[model samples]
Target: MTTIDHAVVLGGSIAGLLSAAALAPRAHRITVVDRDPLPLEGPDAQVARRGVPQGDQIHHLLMRGQERIEELLPGIGDELLALGCEKYDDVADFSQFVDGAWRMRIQSDLKVTMFRRPLFEWAIRRRVLALSNVTVVKGMAVGLLASSDGARVSGAKVRGAPGGTLAADLVVDATGRGSRSPFWIEDLGYERPVERHVRIYMGYSTWTVRLPEGALPKGLAGISASASPANPFGVAIRPCGNGLHDVAAYGMAGHYPPDDLDAMAGFFEELDSPVIADVMKKAVPASEIVPYRMPGNQRRMWEDLPRRPENLVVVGDAVTSFNPIYGQGMTMAALGAGVLGDALAEAGTLDGLAETVQARLGPLAQVAWDLAVGADSVYPQAEYENVEPPSARDRDRARAQSAAQSAEGAVRVAMRATALYMDPAYLGSPVVQETIDRWLTSGHKPAPEVTDPTDPPDVTPGVVRAADLLEPATAAGRLAG
Candidate 1:
């Protein structure tokens, strides 16, 4: 046997649990530490714990994130669907408008899960616990126990029963954005990690409703309004729930939704994207007008750190967190855990695992970082997060200004190109190459897709049933049934 004994995880959120899954098959025992008592399997109410306030926003599982979930947890996605989490194909259902055009591009067979953030995190946590080797315990983590050599972390000092300690061969930090690991390190006489934050002042007031459970008028569609002169707003109404709907209104920094109901209505009426306003204008809206805000796009430069605790690794938002508008945090964290697993499997020692994960994750981090920073740069007060130098490429902004300036069409092209490239390999595909050529006006093809504004999907589409790509997940639930 390989004989790796124990792995300890801090933070029981999405990143932590996913890391647990990656380590499950290899580690003999795993301990997950969190301040909140973990949620039991099945349905539950949302509870606020520590400082994680964004737990209520609409959390979307991007196509890439969904594929990772299926691979690691097997059938948990289906369990989510059966419990009322919504799963739908992106191209078919999403309403996208950018660069002055709508995209009617056919669905690329990508199924995304739209679920309550807490519910989604809970499902993954359950899977982590399902492993006989994993145990969930509630406690606060204070600091790392450093080896005398000062180059390695041996374990952690947690706030368990009056200052308890847990020893491990590997200690993973999935503790989220507010994580105090770095400060704790400095307290132990180490250099603090540097950060790059995209300055964006944003607040969101979200609302969710039960769309009559069985059928609806139209499929789900999302709309976005750009901050550029020709366009100044955006709205997205995506398919969600067991057959329900979620609608959220966002504004650039100070323009976001306010707490006053009357102001809320006016904001909705005048939102950048037209679709959300239309839905809110109708329907008996469900849920309260929940409000939340993320002040900055923060990233800690752990890769460049002069020294890092050998056995310690920080995954998830603790490393980087982007603006929610892009919906990339969850996905980024999942990919991070995947990287952690790969490092553990190959590395002979847990020593320096944190730095290794950071270096390996540099590419994914760059992709998400630029996309967010580019968008934030267009908004007022966005300059402060000066993490990336001003010379960075906002290809869409650059090309749109010089080459393609149509708000509706250009934005769609940008979104489409980016989505296709997420496959990474598709960048080399002939179809993708042609689209790029056409997009740059090679043959001047009419923009590939001009999608209609959509209504919500029906509850019984049977589209999400097992035969679908979501089959890996859907079938798991049916088997359990």
Candidate 2:
């Protein structure tokens, strides 16, 4: 196979880092450019920065995501686990409430680990920078540089650099959700890719709180309550490190979670279960509330464009941005990098590389896109364009199906738990589909063996006094006595 002399990668966060890793072996030199100064500190750094506005929010590295990252950067998982990140069976260790009922805690091999987004990115940045062929250049990419015939991107125009254009054999756009590749492509006299959007107007708030190690019972490291149209809100609490937990409350459409502590507590109290609310009342606040808003899920159809540059490709959130609530961003980014690596190995050179990689990326993202958009479309207030929204009847059917799937012995939970690591089509396997159908129609089945046999114990931490507290809801009344 032929090897490229040099390649350029835009953005230096998770996506850019992984892109560099994938290209390093095939290219003699690689330049990773980012507008934000790359963090040099290692994994334990807790610095929250603006480059990734959602850095402080609760982050879930799904089962598949963890495995993919480990494959790219070997021993990375053990390094993270050594830094106090908790690893456990996502099915057995987490207590989840979806479609209004708690999911049965059945033991499974699916594993997931919890860590802060900033810290995780920091770790990846360190590994990518360690590659001798990869050099991180700090600057913003103002535009793309096309070939003499204007049919391919030769490189990018770096703002405020010694030379106007940084030339390379290939240019990658990993600038994330705010990427301007489509506009740049248009200016280069090529057709812009069609785009799709699903407007959810989601607002979420997060807080980092401190609690004693093992403050709760054994075998429980995370708890979550999913949002539905009936409730329009949800909450998740997971352990980050050093006895610190990250709690996040979210609302869909116009029901935004408040930025104030007392008001935030009120939102938690309103969840179907008191587990998160009780933790909020007792846990000592370690950080102020940080709120984030996402306009919607968007996908740029680069694969559909009839005319495009042969040397340029987009990856990560730049191509497909999903609703962060589903935790698909990081995993999808890794998947894109893998596709790029495979395409390069096949082509033997940069000729016809961009189109091949971009086309392959679309299907890799479609699975996660379907899951996120399908789930979000059920809400009555969400708006979408260029896509068919789920009908009212469809929403009702979905809710009923979800409730049935949440019941004990259902295979759907296990299927979803492994979605990121396996093919999204696995959810449609006859075994899983038939299981859901039988549960819904027959209404009788043997229950799966429960990991936690006893009922949840009352572990309410006493409420503290504060004048700013939102009007008290019957807090104590919600918990078991």
Which candidate leads the pack in TM-score? 2
**Model 2, 36-129: lDDT tens per residue?**
7776765434566677888888877766666677777889998888878877666556676665455555455566777888878887888889
Which portions of model 2 miss their true places by more than 4 Å? 42-46, 213-218, 391-409, 412-418, 421-425, 428-430, 439-481
TM-score list, all predictions: 0.81, 0.87
**Residue-pair clash count for candidate 2:** 0
For candidate 1, write residues 1-481 as lDDT tens digits.
1335988899888889899998888799999888877867434534434446777666666666676767788887788888787666665565445444443434344557777777677667766787899998788888888778667777788887244988878788899888888897887678988878876777666667654432333444433433342434445455556555666666565656675455666665654445555556564666677777778688888788887667778888998887786787888778888888788778776656678888877667666666566666665456564355444334333333222222223323344334322333323334433333445554323333332333322222222221322222332232210
RMSD (Å) of each candidate, 1 decimal: 7.1, 9.6
- Model 1, position 431, has a per-residue lDDT of 42
Clashes within 3 Å, all models in order: 29, 0
Candidate 1: segments with Cα more than 4 A from true spot: 1-3, 41-51, 161-163, 212-218, 221-233, 272-275, 385-481
TM-score of 2: 0.87
